[model samples]
Target: MSKYIIIHVFVRIFSNMQENSKDPITQSNEQCSLTMVRRVAAMLDLDSKSFSEGDLLPKGWHFFMLAGETRKSELRSDGFPGLGVPIPDLGLPRLLLGGRTVSYNGDIVIGSVVEKTSFIKSIVEKTTNSGPMAIVTIQHELRPISETSPAIIETQTYILLSASKASNNSEKTLSQPIEAEHQKNIIPDETLIFQYSALGFNSHKIHLDRSYAQNSEGLPDLVVNGGLTTLLLTEYIRTNLGLEITDIKVKHIAPLYCNRPMTLTAKKSETDWKLYVYDNNNDIAVEAEINVK
Candidate 1:
């Protein structure tokens, strides 16, 4: 039987097992400063010269500033906060950011103190062709400390890997290169990864140490920041399409390594849009949907 069918069957069975039993975990409210925003934009090589204090933060930049887990002493060798966040144990040794959606409800200023409340939303165990893995859903809501309403809510999932190493057969699942004509391409180099990692204060070694990623994590090369790709699509939607975004939904299909050129593609879908990012090899790396009004 095919892996997708197996995954679907198990997902249907386990869907109910994962439910709302856990309490919400709230982190100390963190301050959103202009310095942090500009630093992130600069690291992503974005044009932040005109950025000001009270302007609404562009899409995806929130990943850099909000919901920060501040336990430095708990970091694993790989730089992940080993026990910092409440991700379900798949008995897996590896973790990857699968994708996320940011729904904007309001705005925040540079000096605004924002409160972050997060919880473990769900945990779905599936059998992949390579092995068994778990898809852990986590939700975070960010609001100004002074306001009772949330400004943005981010829903993201993480892929937990069971095997200590990535499987070679999994590489065959890649589809033919995307040949879409109307798309913009951006080159991601090692430096970009460095800047982005710093901007997000990410301690994950996968983005910085190519050797560790290749040897320890079994990745082909340095993985670009998934959040960066997400924000890029959001920014493109804002500037090129002139869309006023209300919601974003995304899923990571594959990894795009440093030194690869990523192609961004989007098409209108009713009042919304479907977007994709293709890696240098032409495989769709990320799939996304943007709802605009």
Candidate 2:
């Protein structure tokens, strides 16, 4: 049998298992605490050595990356690749992120416990020239060491990269130019969250463990992850333009914060699409170009 057929069979069996299995409650109303952040951060590879001398990550960022990596792991055990790795079977449900929303309550300090809860919000499937891809949405909530108003809530979109197009450096031939846009929505924040160093399994620290972020990373505060921003931009385009994005490349210019709102801008020139996420302050958080056919 062909590899694609084998992968498709596995995906079918896995999907059936998912449908028959008991649905677990993935969402929580709890506030983010320091302890919870610490545990999750450690698993994600966040540690003390990662911090810079002064500037560092804020609190909410920690919860963001943790939930993302955790979600990836969950999908893998059900028959997919883990985070940062391409999926094996080309026939499996190709998951890709569309966008996310994260609310920030207050700051999480070092040695503090953060209250966190997460849930799967939505899942959708689409057929592309490459194959079938599934979009999975998940939500996460975070709070201060002490319970307070405006707890941070984050929604994330995950895209399971299709295996059919699998190859070393699979994104090489997918490059294109930026499109044009007039009106756009942007989110802004002052102290962007960031990872202190190559601390944890997480190369995306702007999303995890804030202590190192603030004191070590040299960032004003904890910064949001560039990857998350890309996900949001892709999600925005998919919803607004309804285009099948074969590949995307994004470049980060500045950092984003916990509660800040970012704008997503898009335009089309010839056969390519250009998109950007701007911080509320009007700074370019990230820029991306997509090839859609």
Candidate 3:
């Protein structure tokens, strides 16, 4: 059958399923664990002693609170836990982090209990030249038990694509180098990738299993977790610029592989700050805009 006909049929089938299925919403509670915060600091080679029970949890560090507890048997074939929320089985096997928007409304203190509410915000099915694909948006609200209002709100978008053959590395192209006011370079190794994945309770094979990444996903090596990339950017701004972030929107343009050096650059404008993560080949892998106080 022709690709066009296949996509058309798939779209009709998905539409029927969409009409019958309802989006899922879930609520949970987690402690802003001081131990976890110290571990994260140690993982980043920062002083673990710097984090304390009463200290405010750093912005973007709330990712661990949203980690999904999906059992092994219930995990998706791709090994994604869906960030603690149940994702509909849309018949699409491949998943990628398209981007995320995060708003910091207040502070979450270490050792405080947090109430988390997560729900699917939107799902759209579309046809692309590669094949039929779906975009899923999930939103999470985290409020400290002591406060009535949410401390942090985050929306993450994922791209779901039909299974396909492994990608060819030779087809990759480099992006033009970006000019920035400040920049830092770091090589994300297997250890860093493993630590971040473990902390977030993420078991995605693309970030953990090398053979699966190369043979199954057609990637050159294990891919870096997109959340980790965003965390690093936030830390850079926090430490180097010493700015307080109110909001951020990030986009993952390309994948950054483990063991490869990636440069993080920031440019300050009159309004907000722009950040970019350039892969080893000088390709822009991630882009973000930050609004600060």
- TM-score (all chains, Cα) for each model: 0.83, 0.39, 0.91
lDDT of candidate 2 over 179-236, digit per residue (tens): 3463345442322223322222333332454554454344444456555465456556
lDDT of 2 at 104: 42
lDDT agreement of model 2 with the native: 0.47
Candidate 1: global Cα-lDDT? 0.74
Model 1 Cα lDDT, one tens digit per residue, 1-293 = 45455553234122222253444464667778788888877775567677888787776677765435657786655776532256544577678998887898887777678987776666777776677788777777888988988889887778777648654222455567676545788988988778777776777888888898889878888888787788778878877777778899989988888887889998876767889998776777899988887
Which regions of candidate 1 are displaced past 4 Å? Answer: 1-24, 82-84, 88-90, 126-130, 168-181
Q: Which ten residues in a row have the lowest lDDT in candidate 2?
A: 9-18
Q: Quick one: how many clashes does candidate 1 have?
A: 0
- Alpha carbon RMSD to native, model 3: 3.9
Q: 91, model 1: CA deviation in Å?
A: 2.6
lDDT (Cα atoms) of all candidates against the true structure: 0.74, 0.47, 0.87
Weakest lDDT window of 10 consecutive positions for candidate 1: 9-18
Candidate 3 off by > 4 Å? 1-22, 170-178
**Winner on TM-score (1 vs 2):** 1
What's the CA RMSD of model 2 in angstroms? 14.1
